[model samples]
Target: MDYGIWNVIELLGALGFFIYGMKVMSEGIQKAAGDNLRSILGTMTSNRYTGVLTGFLITAIVQSSSATTVMTVSFVNAGLISLVESAGVMMGANIGTTITGWLVSLIGFKMKISAYALPLIAVAMPLMFSKKPNLKNWSEFMIGFALLFLGLEALKEAVPEIQKSPELLSFLTQFNDPGILTRLMFVGVGTILTIVVQSSSAAMAVTIVLCAQGLPIEIGTAMILGENIGTTITAELAALVGNVHAKRSAKIHSLFNIIGVTWMVIMLPYVLDLLHYIWPAPETGDPNKFTLALFHTTFNFMNVMLLIWFVPSIVKLATRLVKSKGDEDEEFSLTNINYDAPLTAEVSILSAQKESIKFAEITKLMFTNLKELLNEQKQDTRDKLKAKISKLEVRTDEIEERIADYLVRVSEQQLSIESSVKVRSILSIAHDLERIADIILRMSKDIERGNKQKSIFSEKQNKNIKEIFGLVDLSIEQMITNLNGVYGKVDISGAIETEMAINALKTKMRKQHLKSTEKKEYDVQSGIIYRDLFFAAEKIGDHVINVSEAVRGDFGKDDEDM
Candidate 1:
């Protein structure tokens, strides 16, 4: 407290830059890897050990266990990863996180490293100036690493001066008189900092560096505990914007970390003693930061080892922890179509395309409800069908929002050239799908409004409309299903069939409209509703054709206009 106020300001400012730099670095790494990290982690389901390794590699590359866990939770929500599989990945993430601690440890003590840090700036500057995104990301990594070391050095240098201050020394002495409550408080501090920062690696990195530089063990351990709790905040925030399953996945991550940290805190003295025993180098002259890094790594690895067998239990616990207080919101549940995972978002898009088709199938139920409205003469039955149709419409809107949001998040991220193209195609198709949703809603409203006027399609008109609408449904189903397959792009023989049939249907419907008009089939109001319904249906088909074309890579004129 008695240290120079200016020095204190400098220390805080340096630490702030360090935290900020780590953030930039972590985000760059994540954006660079994008969905590829999810894909890699998603593949490790059969073997627990393999999953552990996958998790580690992904977290190491991503530079944040919280990000990895949240991504894993997103995957879980999408049904891409089983709970058991996720646990293994989570385990690996813990161990992988140690890489940063080791990296920080290397940077913390060696004064000569700062010389290289300056060279990193020189090397990175050009890369930052380059036109390439990859190069920019490389620069970002460089600047982040440099600032990280710079901050740690400032903190270490600042600490020894504060060591002479009575107020700070007394504060350190108060915590050093350790016991169970004190350790829990320490864990509490770690959890709180991690929660606040949403970055476990940052918290851990600082803890290792500070402890190695002689911040008392009690203080360092408290901060580490806070880091674990803090990591969960990232997943919690992500899940809030996500669905129930996503929330549950985050819950699993948080629960597991809490469990690990809780037990570790209870066993604090013993665990710290174990680390000291395992690596006797820390107590020697010029304390080894590597020892701290090693301790963090092993503690998490051992926790994962101890708990992985109980994955099912953890899953059950997480589910209860994240229980829905009411019925699942259909809109969010419908989002089983996950576009972002450890795998590339594009690959996830392909996977989501399949899920979208299922949504289409669910959509066809709207037609069935419509048909019931047509056949039933009773007001009660009609009202019930109308309500059901309305409910279905609401569900579709929710689905569209969920999808658009997910894709939007993916869109904002750095994507590969190929992935970017795929995303464009996917976005185009999603637009088409969303348009179809519009047509469905319009159709529902039209039928209800038309029914109010008591107008029936004449025999010939009825037959033609049903036949054409049936074809429209068939084409859309095929289009959505084949979107990424041979049927999706290129003239998968069906393209010709689809184009011809849609054209014929359009022509046939046109003639039927002419005949209805010639016959003076109904009142002006009835005719207007009929015409609008027919026009809406045709437009839906047109959009479907365009989507299919977009899927097939026929994007020249249309996209250029946009």
Candidate 2:
């Protein structure tokens, strides 16, 4: 009866502090191991099982299932990981998040960790002032860690004692009845609480604390199940603006948890009995905290075990649920790089690198179409091909703009020297790829015009132009390899050789065309078309070499030669 609005504000403030501390700690860890985290996520999630473990480990370390799921969704959006693999990771993330409940129960509630919070801050302050970047990051982690426990302590004090608050207890007792409807109601309460907090870990802590304060364990278990369902909302929110695949991954996460919760509700009594047999609550102290922690862990582990075999089915169901619109739907979109998610410079750079590679591949496809347009003799086919090439040119413009914007955004984040340099290189590569697409589109249009004007190249001239196209194609291939980072070093020698070959071929062909024109073998109109094609091919080769140079970090070096 005596509870005031200020009490509610104080409680909310304490919860905010806890969430902020978790965020700060998660970010510190991400920054410290950003590169390594990228490598692990890139290489380790090759299969469903490994993917699950990767998810588990990342969530465990970050202590935020929401972060893990969001990262997983982003990777799926980026095409860095498959939907099936992402499902495994999501499952593992659910299990990993249970660690927080155990932590809160075993340490935050049991020990006087808050008393040492200031001392930990005192120790971290000196390291924060250190010149070393790693030290600074570690100091930040320690500070967050201290703040987390301090907030936890404050939260414990802020939550009113339910026994002393008869009116509040009576209100809560209405939903504590032992019935299926009551369990569902409690589950809904848990889900809503987690959605409101946007953190299952925080929700779990609140649930555990309430149970410790004499809330029924059965109701708390229902809340735990609801938290499981609610936690997926974070990933769903992240994937809303993402691609179809990302949406499917998020859907799969939701389905997995929801289905698991549904089954657990049916078998609630049996499951709780099993959990209690394995890890019984204390007789004197708050048994509910221990019971809830064990229940949380057991529920996730069981869900993963039950659903791991159904991953393929889940993937198929998700795919069917979220259908792609069509080819236009596949147009270049930045799904993987969520600006709202906690971003590290290393991860942002990786996303940019992948986008750059995709940019190169798109340009290569445009060049292939250009080559097709060059040889097609049928007017209808040529027109259609021209339209396709023109569309691709527009798409390339979009890709370039998106990639550049992504890189610029990434550069705005705190980046290391190396990451900053890489961002610049990627931006340059995107620009060159865009130009290459434009040149190919121009070449296609030239062919269209030549066909319309009845100024076709002679048999011999067409053969020579095809040869130049061949050389340009090889140069594009080399540029793609450079972008893939397969060479491990700045090996621009092949690019340089291809450039020299393109130049020599262009000069020889131009001289031959002039001689042919002088002999009246080709008319002035035909000569102009042939020269335009030759110049365009040579320009494409130049752009390819520029991309290669950017990949090799030699963007401005030897500008005269380029």
Candidate 3:
């Protein structure tokens, strides 16, 4: 048997085509059902069982458990789902991945689906050219589905017949012993193969092909288990640059698979017997393929069943494993934003909306800190509070930039009119929150200047300033309420009234301050600083109104109070 360099290249190319086709198909489904996917994930994972079913359904639809796991991790990172729920989803994803194995065994090897790839593509081409977005997406899905099966066929053809290639079979035979050590060795090989290819489904296809080509079912099963462990590498890599929670989610995935593989390795023979009992292999002609598929499915299903009760324990372990740094260390970064998830424009808008709400909360905290900064009389405490405010301002700047960049990229996608409006609203709200942070920071600086000049406010002046801060805080609270959809409808009436009251208070304070300045109650410098602080505080209220208007999606409407 002469297997040369070109043969290796051809096999690699076929694998690449298969992986690429899977990606195309998965992305097409994501684009077509992105909104529904978001809704399903957001609403369906109420408990572990539901989470498992959600994970299974998503993986089945996307045809890639890796995609489902990655998306689940992203959801956790974004705070859309909890780690415990994600654990169940990850478990179900393990089961969902076996669908690929069953697919290969039932149809891929049993039929000549690739022969129809060209005709499928031809039939889908015109739909691909359709002006309607949904039709175009469906055509893309069909084209990718055809290409995927075509690639699978090519992969089967590219690998030289194991019997004809004595050297290759001989190499594989080295790890074919029934000892535990041999099984572990093959598991390592499987893990490495999956990591190299970056797709467990592709690895599964290769495993099935090898089994069909006379590789022992036991050896193939060992590799299949290895693929389980190997598949986790994707989530781990994704979490490397993510936040603490993202890392925890990824760790849970790794621990879940590794632990499941460990138990299966210990009970390998019994598991195999159970699989045979459930669905006995044919007496002859490559029963290993079916056997391996059943093994993959049973291994994952049993793993989920065994571990479902331990979800809290797993989440606790993961939380302890990945500790959070201090507040300063947890600066804003978009590394965990998960741009790689196949989110449609509509779904992406939901994430952006969540982030915008988070932005509002952060700004509200900044304002609370500003109040403390103003009240602090000790030089050290005031300086510390000022520094904290400065840090928060910098963080707000980063959040705005990242969120804006994310929304801009989302806007570039094929968005519906409503999604486009939501994107713009989120962008506006982010910008407004950022400006509010900036104004609060500026007010902090103005307070510091007043303290430096020994320009103490009179008792009445202090009362006026505190009153304005109170009104501004109320406005912020209302803005957050609107953003949270607590009422399910955008109502700006309260926000408008609050903004008007703030403006009227500022007017009255300005008049009293001007009279006091004329009477020489305080120096001109003191008056100027007083006016600056008042103006800055009033500006924050204006920005809060802007955020509310953005949330209401009525930015063009004139304020009735104005």
Question: Residues 1-562, candidate 2, lDDT per residue (tens digit)?
Answer: 5768999999999899888888777756766775566566664458889888888887887788887788778767766678888898898889999998988888898889878889999999999778777777778788888888888888888787887888878877775546787788889999999999988988998888888776878899999999999988888888888888889999999999999999998888888888778877656777888888988888899899999999999999988988998865543454246767654555556667766776787788888888888788887888888888888788778778877777777778665444556777787788888888888888787777787788878899989988998999899898888886621256889989999999999999989988998899988888898999998899989989988877776652335423
> All models: lDDT?
0.67, 0.81, 0.81
Residue 501 displacement (Å), model 2? 5.0
What tens digits encode model 3's per-residue C-alpha lDDT throughout 513-534?
9899889987888789889988
Off by over 4 Å in 1: 41-57, 69-92, 107-111, 129-132, 160-177, 238-247, 273-278, 282-288, 321-323, 328-385, 392-431, 448-501, 508-537, 545-562
- The local lDDT score (0 to 100) that residue 415 gets in candidate 2 is 56
Clashing pairs in 3: none
Q: What's model 3's overall lDDT?
A: 0.81
Best by TM-score: 2
- Candidate 3 positional error at 227, Å: 1.5
- lDDT by residue (tens digit), candidate 1, 1-562: 4557887677667667677767666655654564465457445666667888888887788676765676666655555556677777877887888788877776567565677778988888888767676777668777877877777666666554435567766667777658877777777777776665456776776676566645677667656766767777776765675566677767777777888888877776787778878777634554546656766777787788888888789889877777665655313355544342333343344444544554565466676676567667888888898887777677667666766676667767655444456556666666667677667777777878888888776676567667767777777676655553542235645754775686777777777677777887756676776677667777777877777777665642345434
Worst 10 residues of 3 by lDDT: 327-336
TM-score of each: 0.74, 0.86, 0.82
Cα RMSDs of all predictions?
A: 5.8, 4.0, 4.8
Q: Among all windows of ten consecutive residues in candidate 2, which has the lowest summed lDDT?
A: 553-562
